[model samples]
Target: MTRLPVLRTPRLTLRGWTFADTAAALDVYGHAEVARWLSPEMTRVPTPSAMRLLITRWIAECVGLPPPAGRWAIERDEDKRVVGGAVLLRLPPGHEDLEIGWQLHPDVWGNGYASEATYALAGWAFSHDVDEIFAVVRPDNARAAATVRRNGMLWVGETRKYFDLDLEIYRLRSADLKLGAQTSQRPPGHGNDD
Candidate 1:
């Protein structure tokens, strides 16, 4: 339950969520395009206040969550703006597998941010002793499927185990990662919140 690690890629920084990031977060989650993919577990955040409450909950929950299991704000290094969100959480029903997810604003859709975030998350998780990670995409989510593939995840087929809906599962093992593509983590006090 230490502070969420700060992950840095060449162009983006993945750090802990903060109340101060509500508006920027809303810019991503408030849009129908982005929220449509996150069904059942989350709906479109209606307002800045609602987004703030959600961030508060995420912060509180992470304090008790295990290493590599927390949410992160995907910020662009050049502009220092939050462009999306990322998470590594235990899959439901079994809670044995770790799932990696990313949500990006439509404005930044084609920028390779999702792929960068995916690699960063995978590297961070593996460095903490996680053997493998998964990404479950809705059957029709081509963008997500492509992103996972671009990150070197292999399609393992479909399942209805998570969220009670059909999803395409993609997996990446620690041994599959390329050397030097790993992300660098800042210490507890070096992240956004502290």
Candidate 2:
């Protein structure tokens, strides 16, 4: 497998995980509010051992594993602190699609990091031959849903997942590269940059 390369944006760095990031991961993942929109299993604060397992799993996936096609640690350019995570996973055999996901600290909630990261990841995925990219957001997560829409994804209705909960699905086809292009053309803080 080819090594995944690091990606940089105006104020963020998207790169591979490292053991040194444990503390940041613990802080972000342990926050209930941050995990609320994610799977329930991730909601509970994880112990050190559990965090180690999580980091290991992330490393495995970053190495081009089956479950996670790609995962990046979103680091702030100023402090180089790990503020969040962005992931792209290949759907199981039957689904044959790609899924994009992101999680950030509440402090940066309104700053457009999620939207920028999603746009970058979606662009990267399609550039590498992924046919489609989608996100399964909770219906109540208005912020996340808005981010998806801002990135040019269309609502594909709702569906139940392994977690046994109904989720709103938003999708963007490879042909829909316009979203990424539009996002790239805008300066930060103007319009769809959010």
Q: Which candidate is the best by lDDT?
A: 1
Clashes of each: 0, 0
RMSD of 2: 2.8
Residue range 1-194, candidate 1, lDDT tens digits:
47899999888999999988999999999999999998578999999999999999999989989998999999999999999999999999899999999999988877777767877898889889898899999988887886676566778999999999999999888655552133313232232110
TM-score of 2: 0.86
Model 2 error, position 81 (Å): 1.0
On the 0 to 100 scale, the lDDT of residue 10 in model 1 is 82
Q: Say which candidate scores most in TM-score.
A: 1
lDDT of 2 by residue, 19-127 (tens): 8888888788888878787764466457766777888887876775543368788998999889998888764435466789888987777677887687678778877
TM-score of each: 0.90, 0.86
* Per-model root-mean-square deviation over C-alphas: 6.7, 2.8
Q: lDDT per model, in order?
A: 0.84, 0.75
Off by over 4 Å in 2: 66-68, 92-95, 175-177, 180-194
Error of 2 at 107 (Å): 0.7
Global local distance difference test of model 2: 0.75
